[model samples]
Target: MMDEAVLEALDAYVECLFAPQDEALEFTLSASRRAGLPDIQVSPAEGRLLQLLALMVGAGRILEIGTLGGYSAIHLARALPDVGTMVSLEASAHHAEVARANIEHAGLSEKVEVRTGDARKLLARMIQDGEEPFDVVFIDADKRGYPEYLELSLTLSHPGTLILADNTFRGGAVVQPADETSRVLHEFNLSLARDPRLDSILIPVVRERVDGLSIARVKNI
Candidate 1:
């Protein structure tokens, strides 16, 4: 968490590894700009990794807990085949509309659906409706709600599903545990690692943040 300089260099390395955006990604970025949102973006490197994860997992269905201006959504959706569907939950109607335009520009409206509502409520609804389980679940939204999202997403995921949760590092706060956000995140990481059902690792990705991805198989006895 104290390795800010190294993190920056690693981010640079990630960008260097991925080539410049294709036409689709270019259009997606353009749409996000047009929508007057600037924070909704993933680094070029992370986007490529998300695409690879989808392909590697043969993901036909993905569940994204956040749809921030549709940046990460586009990254994850790029992994989907023609019939794949990425269902994202967002809390802001304004942002959801902005994400929709960006999704349209990215030509992923057919493959991704952005639903604006409280994620907790939405997940409960999804459970009740008996929706199909997802192959991958990406959690990058509200910091405090991560535990709840993780718990619910696990219910909707199969044994081999991949779960990626963002912002675990919380900018050096996780080590100090002085602030409220840091405390929760630190606990989340500790619990995830200790949980008998999970095999997890945290990778430093951005300033004050770690992409905490865990791979696990549901142990059905």
Candidate 2:
């Protein structure tokens, strides 16, 4: 309901107070830019929210469906315990390589691995291999694949596992759902709400525009 500029300023204010970037995060952003990656990484406030959520869930194993220059990965990995680990899937080999370098620069290589491939294939393979369930799964990949990703992620999660999806609002388009992507996202939100295995809510996140992040906790296997 607020002006866009005001919303951005509020985000900045929150970031300045609670998510101030240190050297590693700054380096990650700069290196990501140098590599010509899209500037679609989570905002600092949202990154901090991810970190806090990981900490709240005491996540030991984290799975990320998208790794864009490792910006959000750094935040999530920072929440891990010394022995905790994360596996992030990136569709672009170049993005994965950039993410690896950024993560290494952040001294988080030991805690994080960036795998390059189609996220759906990678997730399906992990499921077929009977991989250990993850404590948290962050979904931030292609919009159209969101529903499939959610289903696959559930296969990789256990009771109490936390699931997060970004850009659910599609800049407020989900309300009217004018396009295919928005309609899909709208239905995704509806499914999240009705799915018996999970309890979920969509929280608005502001940047250049209003978007949303859907947070769900698996209540039953």
Candidate 3:
């Protein structure tokens, strides 16, 4: 197995060749750093991967949980058509503010809406409002609540809806989780994979952090 540093260097090299970060995205990252947000945002390659996946699914209405500085939101929004829209749910008001500004900087203000509230509550409200089913949903919020997020997402989705969950691997902890968060996340991963309603795969994305992403498509409902 390659060392983490070597793997990262290789990933960086591949990103330069396949998905170089553009100026707007660079500015978004810069703004996030200036705002003192955690650098837990997806790497440029991961963001590009999300964009490509969204494009592949031909997503129109995208839903994002955990809009930290709107970094991933920008990438997902960019994958949409001119008329496409994305609503991102964030629990932290301060983070949401930074995300909104960063999204504007990325020229995606019209395409992305950063809502500040508890994700579970907002999702419930969306259901009560009878919002249309989303084409794609991305979950990146608290690990302990992932199962609930999956349940809520299934409620808000339809057949063929793309569902993605980030940080599934969680620094290799899923293999032998030592904390409640890791154990729950590990269970969530297992549940997602075993669920009959969706087709799913877990992909290891090697960045500064050893995180994995889960992509699932609703099949029967």
Candidate 4:
């Protein structure tokens, strides 16, 4: 097996060779750092991967469950058609404000809208309002809320909707479940794989890391 440092270097080299982060995204990350937000945003390669996934599905409408500084939202929205719509939910009003500014700075304000509130509550409200189903849904909120998020995602998704959840591996603790978060994430992964309504798989983005993303496609409803 390759050393962790070597693997990370390879990942970075691959990204540099193929999909590098652009200026707007770079500035977004810098700004997010200056604001003292958590450094938990997806990596550049992962951001490009999300864009590729969105493009592959020709997503017109996208749903994002966690909008921290709008970093990933910018990537996903960029994959949409000119008239596409993307709704992002953020739990922190302050974070939502920061995200809005970053997204606006990226010139994506016309395509992305960040809503402030609990993700679960917003998702439930969307269902109650009979909102149109999303083509792609990305969930990256609290680990303990993943199961509920997946359930709510199903309600707001149609056949062929792509659902992506990040941080599923939970730093390798998921195997032994060292804590509540890890245990819930493990259960969430198992549930996603066994769920009859979706075809699911775990995709490893980084080398030797217990953190990876989950991709699930909804079956015909």
Candidate 5:
């Protein structure tokens, strides 16, 4: 297995080759840092992967459970066609403000909406309001919230919708699952695999450490 340094170098090599950051993306990271946001946003390579997945699915509408400084949101929104739109849920009002500013700076304000509130409550409200199904749902929030997020995301997805969750491997913790978060993530992966309405797989992603992105396509319902 590659050491952390090698893994990071490999990630940088991939990002340099295929996901070079633009001015907007650069500004997003800088602003996010200035605002003291956690540096837990997806890496550049993973952001590219998200964009590619969104494009591959021909996503017209996307839903994101986390909007950390709008870094990933910019990537996902860029994959949208002119009329395509996205709604991103952020639990922290401060983070939402930062994300909105970053998105605006990225010239994606018209395409993405960053809503601030409890994700579960917002999702429940969306369901109650009969929100239109999205073509893609990306969850990258609190690990403990993943199970409920997945269930809520399904309510907002249609057949063929793509659901992506980040940090699934949890630095290999899910392998042994000594902690509650790790155990929960392990079970989440299992549920994704066994769910009759979907077909899924966990794609390993490398940064400073090995994590995973869980991708599932809604087969029915």
Candidate 6:
């Protein structure tokens, strides 16, 4: 278990680095509080990274696998061009509804759409319908299904596409693999490391209990 002092120290550092919030960001933060959702929201560093990635990749088309009250999507879409598009999938209608309300309040409804359903099903359907290959894809969904989500998402990416997976650390149990979530994450991490298609890196984020940011670039299709 992580020591309380370490957790407190990390929290202090994160608070110190907390970025400035605009109307949209404030609303997303409020929605998260109102929903009492877990701390799955993006960190300040990751938020900055998302914007950088979007602009760098010219992310005209984006796909997000976990809406989580639209925190990450808002960060990403804020970086997107006026003509850019972002489609987010949330299994919980409650969360999706909150996200839509916040997106609309932020005047981004036209550029971002929050769909409610199983992410796997929704992604498969989008593929069948000929949606253009996503330029940026973020996966922060159910822990046990991380591998499946990663595999499915890879099929829709090109060399320029960026795939970011959250919570790959699973509170440091990933290195041990004693629990199911850790075991799955461990397998996923190993697979990601070996995959020839992607050049990747893992960043430790969060409190004394760390999480990960796995940034992978797909090779040419």
- What's the CA RMSD for each of the models? 2.6, 0.7, 1.1, 1.3, 0.6, 2.1
lDDT of 2 by residue, 1-221 (tens): 77989998989999999999999999999999999999999999999999999999999999999999999999999999999999999999999999999999999999998999999899999989999999999999999999999999999999999999999999999999889999999999999999999999999998878889999999997
Checking candidate 5 for backbone clashes, the offending pairs are: none
* TM-score of every prediction relative to native: 0.87, 0.99, 0.97, 0.96, 0.99, 0.90
lDDT digits (tens) for residues 157-176 of candidate 1: 87778888877877557878
- For model 1, the stretches where C-alpha displacement exceeds 4 angstroms are 1-10, 38-40, 206-221
Worst 10 residues of 5 by lDDT: 1-10
lDDT tens per residue, model 3, 45-107: 888889999999999999999999888999899999999999999999989998998888888
Evaluate model 5: give its TM-score. 0.99
Whole-model Cα lDDT of every candidate shown, in order: 0.78, 0.96, 0.91, 0.91, 0.96, 0.83
Off by over 4 Å in 3: none
lDDT of 4 by residue, 1-221 (tens): 45788778877886897678788898899999899899999877888899999999999999999999999999999999999999999999988988999999999999998999999899999999999999999999998999999999999999999999999987677879989999999999999889999999997777445378999999965
Model 3 lowest lDDT segment of ten:
1-10
Best by lDDT: 5
Off by over 4 Å in 6: 1-18
Q: After aligning candidate 2 to the native by TM-score, how far in Å is the CA of 168 from where it should be?
A: 0.5
Alpha carbon deviation, residue 11, candidate 5 (Å): 0.5
Evaluation by lDDT, superior candidate among 2 and 5: 5
